[model samples]
Target: MNSERILILIKPDGVNLGHIGEVITRIELKGYEIESLKVTHATKDQLHKHYANLVDKPFYPDIESYMTEGPIVAIIATGTKIVNVFHRMAGDTDPSKAAFGTIRGDLGREWSDGLLRNVVHSSDSVESAEKEIKIWFPEK
Candidate 1:
C-alpha cells in the first residue's frame, strides 16, 4: 500500500477542553507518525482559503468566528491510507452521532450553543489532504 499524509487539526474546542494530549496519544497509538505539528491562532486569510468551498454559504461567518475563538493545533500525520484512517478516528462532525470509540464520540459533546464544535478535523481523501496540507503547512 502507498503511504499517505493527512492534515489533522485539533480545533479550538479540542485544545481548550484539554484534549490535545489525548488526541495526539490516540494518533500515536494508531501507529501513524506525526510529521509536523503547530499551535496557531488562525488568521482570516487562512480560514477563508481553508473553507473557500464554504465561504459563499450563509453560515460561513459562523464557522470563521468559531474557528478564531482560540488557538488550534495543526498536524500532519503520515502512514498508509492515513487520510481515510484519520477520518474514521475523528468520527462524525456531530459528536453525538459519532461512535463510542472515536475521538469526537468520546471527547466532544452537543453543546448548548448548538454549534458543531467537533474536536478535530481530518482530510477526507488524498486529493483533499494535499490541498489542505498546503493551506495549513505551506512551508512544507
Candidate 2:
C-alpha cells in the first residue's frame, strides 16, 4: 500500500473539552487509517523541541503552557496525501477564519486566554509529517 503518515495532535483544549472521539471519527471517515494513538501530557522540553522554530516567538511561552495544561491525544494517521488531507481537515490555525465543517471550524472558538486554542494540529507537509511523526511516535 502506498501511504503517507502524518501526525495529529488533539491539543489540551480539545482533550479537556472531550472532542477526541469526534476528531478521530472525522479522520477515519475521511478514509485515513489510525496507525497509532496515545493520550499523554506533554512536557516543556518536548514541546520546546517540537516547536523549536517558534521558540523565539513572543507567544512561545503561552503556547508551551497551553500545550502542557492537560493530556493531549497524539495520533498517527496514514493514507495517500495524508499530510495535506489532515491539514485541510484540521482547518485554518485561526478558528475565527476557518471554513465551516472543518474540525476547528465546528468546535473551536477564540478563547479569552491569550494563546491560540485551535482544537487540533496536523502536519502541514510531507517533510513536516516525517519530522513530527518521529517526534511523537519514535517507536514507529
Candidate 3:
C-alpha cells in the first residue's frame, strides 16, 4: 500500500491560541495518522531553509520574526493524498477569508501583523511534503 506523508505546522498563532489539540483532533478525525509530533522553537536556519523560495522576498522578515517568537506544533501526518486533503482542511491563508468548517475558519483569526500570523502551514504537494518533512522532522 502507498501512503503519503505531509508536513503540517500549527503556526505560532495556532499554538498560542491553544488550537494544537483541536488541530490534531481534526487530522485524526479525517483519518490521517500522525507519525510524529512536537512543540519546538524553529531555528533561523530551518526557517530560512523551509521558506527558501521566499527568503529574498520583502515579507520574509516578518515571517521570520513571527515564526521565531513562539513555539509551533510540528506534525508529520500520513495517508493517501494527505498533502492535498490537509491543505483544504487548513483553509485559506487568510483566516477571515477561509470558509466555515475549516480549521482556520473555526479557530483562526486575523492579526494586525499583516500576513505574519495566519494559523497554519501545510505542504502544498506530495513532493513539497517530502522536502518539508525533512525540514521540520529531519530525523524522521
Candidate 4:
C-alpha cells in the first residue's frame, strides 16, 4: 500500500495548555495512523532550520522564543493524502479565521503577542512533508 506521510508539530502553546491528547485524537479519528510521536523542547537551531524561510522576518525572534519555551509534540501521520487532510483538520494559520471544527478553531484564540498561536503545524505539500518528516523523524 502506498501511503503518504506528513509531519505534525503541536506547538509550545498547545503543549503548555495540555492539548496534545486532543490533537492526536483528532488525527486518529480522521483515520490517519500515527507512526511516531515525541515530546521535546525545540532548539534554537531546529527552529531556525524549520522556519528558515521566515528567519529574516521581524517576528521570527518571538516565534523562535515561543517554540523553545516548552515541549512540542512531533508526530508522523500516515494515510491517503494525509498531508492535505491533516492541514484541513488543523485549520487556518490564524485561529480567528479557522473553521469551527478544526483543531485551531476549536481550541485557539488570537493572542495579543501577534504570534498567531494556532496550536499546530502540518506540512503543506508533498515536498515539504518529505523534508519535514526527515527533520523530525530522520530514522524513518
Query: Best candidate, TM-score-wise?
Result: 1
Cα deviation at 60, candidate 2, in Å, is 0.3
* TM-scores, one per candidate: 0.97, 0.96, 0.95, 0.94
Task: Report the C-alpha lDDT of model 2 over 13-124, residue by residue, as the tens digit.
Answer: 9999999999999988988899999998888877877898999998898898889889999999999988887898889999999999999999999988657899999988
| Sliding window of 10 residues with minimal summed lDDT for model 4 | 109-118
Report how far off residue 69 is in candidate 1 (Å): 0.6
Please give the distance, in angstroms, between residue 32's alpha carbon in candidate 3 and its true position after superposition: 1.0
- lDDT tens per residue, model 3, 72-125: 999999998788889999888878989999988888887765564777999999
Expressed as tens digits, the lDDT of each residue in 2-38 for candidate 4 is 7898999999899988999999899888888999999
- List runs of model 2 lying over 4 Å from the truth: none
Candidate 1 vs candidate 3, TM-score winner = 1
> What's the number of clashes in each of the models?
0, 0, 0, 0
Worst 10 residues of 1 by lDDT: 110-119
Please give the distance, in angstroms, between residue 107's alpha carbon in candidate 4 and its true position after superposition. 0.7
Per-residue CA lDDT of model 1 for 1-140, tens digit only, reads 99999999999999999999999999899899999999999899989988989999998988998899899999999999888889998999889999999999999998787777998999898988889889999998
| Candidate with the larger TM-score of 2 and 4 | 2
